[model samples]
Target chain A: MSVKLEFNDETLLCKLNGEIDHHTTLPIRLDIDERIESCRPQTVVLDFSNVTFMDSSGIGLVMGRYKVLNELGGTLEVTGLSDNSYKVMRLAGLDRIANIKKGGSKNGNQ
Target chain B: MVINEFKMTVDSRSVNESFTRATVSAFASQLDPTVEEINDIKTAVSEAVTNCIVHGYKNSVGRIYIGVKIHNDGMVIITIRDRGCGIADIKKAREPLFTTLGGDRAGLGFSVMESFMDKISVRSTINKGTTITLYKKISGRAK
Candidate 1:
């Protein structure tokens, strides 16, 4: 998986691509966490517009990140989830911890 | 009657998780499943295979067996077997967010499988192996 990171309006946005399963989550998590440590954005945003497939590992990724950001007093948000991804996210109870929105590449600006 | 079935074995490696999901989904395409149905099957398959690689094997390499049977009644039955360490407590393992694995594990594999598939059952013998079977019906065409 590939992650494109940017900082806009005090938010660190990560755009993820390709399938996300147990195998591909380590690197993505490490990269995002490292950035969260270095940049220390007020809110860490994950953009899933290009994520083709995801399993429970996606939930783990989000949940783990939520803990990391919360510990650092930062917030988390996710955007651009497809119908199925949103279901998985909600199933894992991520909706309660993170601000998740459904939209395309526009970055939740529908 | 079983219209068709497929089985394959792969190494208990993380890289094979995605491959297994795609292969199973491709074989499932014969049922003419919808995109949502395909995603559901793929997600369930991923969770099963991942359980084998991440938890069952536990840093060791082994063989993971997967079998799929497509019945004439539009039901797809998938069985994933792993010759790794079996689960000590099956009931606890099936609970949501009760994972023993660290480093980005939500302990929701079984929960995901249960939610995505119509039926799921698990059988395990400590130090022997574990097998999880999933059943789902394609609401599209049966034949």
Candidate 2:
């Protein structure tokens, strides 16, 4: 899996692609955690629209991100998750912690 | 006639190695498995080897014992064994999304194994080791 980072003054958007299995998680975790610390944006959003497949590893990644952002006093949001991704997220109870937006809205903030 | 069998050793770093797995899975594709079945087998194999590397040896240098046997009854059996930290609670570990190593694991390995294979069994102890056996029948399935 590959993760693309988009940074602005207010948000740090993470666009993840490919399968989120064990092989791809460690590097992604370290990289994103470092970015979050350095950038320290107001909000962190993960766009899963492009993700083709995901399993529990992906859920753990999202939970880890939420914990990190919450500690930083910044909120976390998820947008454009595929149906399968959404199912896994909900099953893992991530839909409660992270705001899972349905549409492809650029400004996820209400 | 004796059926074909294959064996390989996989390290944690090489657990993501898909080429060999793809080849093996392709050979077994003649069974005409459903899409979910194929994905489950692949995921289970990946998780088992990963567990050997991550949880079994705790990322230390170790080898995963893997054997693929085609039974005369037209059944495919894949076994992965690790001589590392054995599981304390196989039942708890098998629970979906229940990982002992925090983010170090996804806790879906056993679940995926059960989902993909026709039968899955695990035997382990505290320090001796752990063995995961997966079985799938190769008959009456469509490609």
Candidate 3:
């Protein structure tokens, strides 16, 4: 998986591409956390437009990030999730912890 | 009635999760499952394989055996087995949000598999290994 970060004021837009599974979660989590700690964004928006596949590992990635941002008094949002990806998120009950939008800008502002 | 059967043994590595999913999905393609059904199978297979890699081998690099059986009635059966440190408490392991790793793992692997598949059974022996069997009935919408 590859993650591109965009800073929008206090929101850190994370555009994720490829598959998010066990093989990719570790590096993805480290990279995202590193940026979150350095930037301290008020909101972290994960863009899943390009993510073709995700498993339970993706749920852990999102939940782990939620905890990190929550501890900082911030929040996380997910947008542009494909049908399958969104279903996985919902099945894992991630929508309860993070704001889920059907589609939005890469920056997650829309 | 069995239509086809496929089996493979792969290293218990995170990268092989995708391979496991792909291989199962390809075999299920003959039944012409819908996109949602295909996704469900992929997700279920991923959870099983991930369990073998994470909890079974504990990153020690072992081998996981995967078996797929396709039924004439559009049913698919998948079995994943790993010869690693087996689960001491099978009941607790299947619980959602229960994880021994206690880090990035959500412990939702079994739950996801249960939700996606029609039936699931888990058998394990401490210091022996674990075997997970999943069954799904496809709608067979292929034209």
Candidate 4:
């Protein structure tokens, strides 16, 4: 499983690990959406510190989640993004839709 | 000057996305690219491969062809080709946030590829297929 779910207060935290790609996103999307539907939290945070690599698929995952949370009147926060991931997010215009925070760790699990 | 190249064909399935990225990255290892440089190549290749799997062969299974070449001058060239439905409008498709796949897709695959790689070329025929070639230079190579 690439996603680990945790509920803190009214926020749903999804800690993502492994490499995120087109094939792996199906399960991850289902996992996160299931949690969002169950709790309907005020904010859903996608933590990517542990994610080793990401492509445009990661952008799609975040956009899809944002739509889900938006329907529930909840917001989305992206955190723990490595520099490489952070750059991709910015290019996808994610910074405008969600609060994005860079991860403290170096790239590739270092 | 050292030169290396490889070619591969894989099923246009989501499961092969990561594999394609890893394979291309490994071949690029011949240039001894830095972490950042390698990551750039991986991400760019992923976008192209994802396009083949998700967009090119959206409704059916097909074969995806990929070729990579590295020059001692620190340049890497990768070509991803798909024998599936071709894009009608290459310009619009390359636009960021433009996607026909809709749900769960940012339509930024081409943009991401263009961003990570120094240059990108796209060619397609209505019913033929789409072929994309990406170019990037790996800086910081030792003399």
**Top DockQ model:** 1
**Model 3: per-residue lDDT, tens digit, B36-80?**
999999999999999998889995999999999988888899999
Per-residue lDDT tens digits for candidate 2, residues B1-143, read 22768787766565443543455566556566665556556656766777777788885767778888776666778888888999998889988877877654556667666765789999998877899998887664422
Highest lDDT model number: 1
Residues B19-80, model 1: lDDT tens digits: 99999999999999999999999999999999999888998999999999999999999999
Clashing pairs in 2: B32-B142, B32-B143
Would you list the rank order by lDDT, best first? 1, 3, 4, 2
Query: What lDDT would candidate 1 get against the real structure?
Result: 0.92
Estimate the Cα RMSD of every predicted model relative to the unseen true structure.
Answer: 1.3, 4.3, 1.9, 2.6
Docking class of 2: acceptable
Per-candidate clash tally: 0, 2, 0, 0
What is the TM-score of each predicted model, taking all chains together?
Answer: 0.97, 0.76, 0.95, 0.94
**Alpha carbon lDDT of residue B65, candidate 2?**
80
2 against 4, candidate with superior TM-score: 4
Off by over 4 Å in 2: A49-53, A79-90, A100-110, B1-5, B14-24, B69-76, B103-106, B115-118, B136-143
Please name the candidate that would achieve the greatest TM-score relative to the true structure. 1
Native interface contacts retained, candidate 3: 0.83
Error of 1 at A107 (Å): 3.4
Per-residue lDDT over B77-122 for candidate 4, one digit per residue giving the tens place of the 0 to 100 score: 8999998889999999999899997778888898998888899999
What is candidate 3's lDDT per residue for A1-109, written digit by digit as tens?
8999888799998988999899888988998999999999999998887888999898999999999998999999989987787877898889899998665555434
Residue B116 lDDT in model 1?
Answer: 98
Q: Give the Å error, residue B38, model 3.
A: 0.8
Q: Residue B33, candidate 1: how far off, in angstroms?
A: 0.4
